[model samples]
Target: MSQFLRSSSIHEILAFFGDLEKTRLQSISRMFYDKIIPSSLQQCFLSLLTKDKFFSYSKEQGDILYYYDIPTRTWIDVKAANHQEHYIYYSMSAVVTDLNRVLLIGGSFDPEFEQYTDAVYDWNQITNRIQPLSNVPFVSFDNGFFYYRGYVYIIEGHVDLFNQSTVRKTARFNVLGNYWQTLPSLNHANGKFNMCAFKNGFIYAFCEQMSSFYRLNSNLLGFERSTNWDLQYIQWERILIKPSVYFGFKMAVFGLNDNQILLFGGDDEFNNQITHSPISKEFSDANALKILDLTDLSLHKIVDDANQDLKIELPDMFYFNQLSEYNGKIYALGKDHIHIINLSKKEIEIIKDDGDYNEEDY
Candidate 1:
């Protein structure tokens, strides 16, 4: 209220206000919401104008929760109405939670990973429901959540399925106290990885038929009243590079700052072939866009002509699973559409599919 706009009795009531008295001062500022403003400063200014756009999950539908719109590039179904059934999207692990909700994690329903799932689904886009909070003391699958700074890092995945083994179990969720701490494991455990997060909270993991590139140290996520884990040194830095490509499953590496990194698509060996395909010019130097440089940790290749894999044209190369970027566009996703990309004038668009996606049966 800034003392009712610096009172001279509101400067003699804004000389009779205006715009219909600014719509009656916004209905008298909603009757001074909780008396002179204080609903946690309207949730701390709507979480500082939060802009995650959308990322809902939970096999969406079976337990309702869709969210993926970013300006009519649809996926709708914020049909909350409170739903939940162990948010199973197999081998579950989705994260967009810091209170902007949508958190499903750790899943498995018999692909013989031995009936896993330490359930923990959230959703709640204003009660378009899917709740069931704590229960993942352990259970893995292609894991990787890492929500940095506000803490939520799950990390470790690939838990034994005929030896895709890996278990230094990591899990440190605390989304404003929905508690689930314990994150200091993984000295190089294996199985489908990819955890990028950088600049000041470093994390650059790597898995899937491993080739070494671990790092994970940024005071190892400190929090004992502001960092001081015995003078900090939380480990994991196997960056002893060796092999070459194919990593962190269903591929698409991220982090474009703190010394670049951008990889894409998987399978330089996972079903044995089919990793680079802007339109299947096949392998095109392993998906023409691999950067990974952490200042000499080398792994370059940037094929000019704006990534000419036949001058880019991907409606669906399975959309390349995931490859974030935001605000400067890079998306990629799949199972329906979204190829956005822009990587600076090397354009690409393809966001179609308004038939309200529930697809994927091929």
Candidate 2:
């Protein structure tokens, strides 16, 4: 039936709804496209606020992922952690996979010393908890992590706190089987590296200290049809981008467009790699934005019109983390300011989270 059978009598419950709501419900749910009944008073109406403009803020609470609604401009809770013992560290790494799952691999709670980051967490959107999963075979802090084709690949760093050893180690966790397996290690050890999955079924990886772009094949078989993947033929081809040794600063890497990757705010100042203490906020300066062109394997620093050369207006107090992209805009989130960078137009709109970060401060 295209139209609702409306009755003017008070017994008709749906008459309470105006003509528009009735038509809307009819188009949304088939229940509204029915004849009016007198005794039936129970029905379900699905109603919710729009979330497209909401920005996800990964707050201090590791378990809970907060969303800042742009329209309301309020910090709202998206989800919270259910597990207690599992450490949701400020040092942790996470990825939102294709399975509609948000997963965190490892992190440490203590700032001075690393504590309990080997376990995996699956954030339940409904429960608002980080459900702990199987542990990796080893522990790490300065690792590179990314999700692709139903698996989480980890580039291991810092074998243990006591060992203090940095070596090329790689592994993968199968979400379907809930298991972890070691893969072939890289040619060199890396710290604070960026590993992002591309649409072309390859990973673009580089450590903060290297100028080479590593294109890696997970070598997993049957990944399209199964949760488990094969790692017998894993390989990495290092493509040298620049020979000047412009090290990668510690920052979050996000996908800009189909052909380029956006490397947002980072700093050259290195923190204690061993301790992983004194987070980026402690740094006195932030770095310029970089875009990695996939087609030519070239990294270009974005230059602002205000600056004469290749430098943008550096917000000294700004430190970007949890880089998130939405509607063709890359949001560089910090404690005090959110720098919304538009790549195509080369524009930046800085929204102060708490204190105002005026260009006069820089």
| TM-score: model 1 vs. ground truth | 0.29
lDDT of each: 0.52, 0.52
Backbone-clash count (model 2):
4
Full-model lDDT, candidate 1: 0.52
For model 2 the local lDDT of residue 27 reads 72
TM-score of each: 0.29, 0.65
RMSD for all candidates, in order, please.
Answer: 22.0, 11.3
Model 1 agreement with the true structure over 1-362: per-residue lDDT tens digits: 76744433433333233324434444565667447444533452343233334454535345555656554456765556754344335545455532244576655354334455666677655655666678777775556665654556666655454554444566666655567776666755444554444443566665544456676665646564332333246766676544455432355566766788776554343433222212222433344556678778887655557455322243233211345556777665654556666766766677664433344521
Give the C-alpha miss distance for residue 124 in model 2, angstroms.
1.4
What local lDDT does model 1 show for residue 12?
Answer: 36
Off by over 4 Å in 2: 1-65, 70-73, 78-88, 108-115, 157-166, 219-233, 245-249, 269-286, 305-321, 353-362
lDDT of 2 at 98: 38
Please identify model 1 stretches exceeding 4 Å from their true place: 1-64, 67-78, 82-121, 124-128, 131-151, 154-177, 180-202, 205-215, 218-228, 235-261, 264-288, 293-296, 302-331, 334-337, 340-362
Per-residue lDDT over 182-217 for candidate 2, one digit per residue giving the tens place of the 0 to 100 score: 665566544544444444556666655444657675
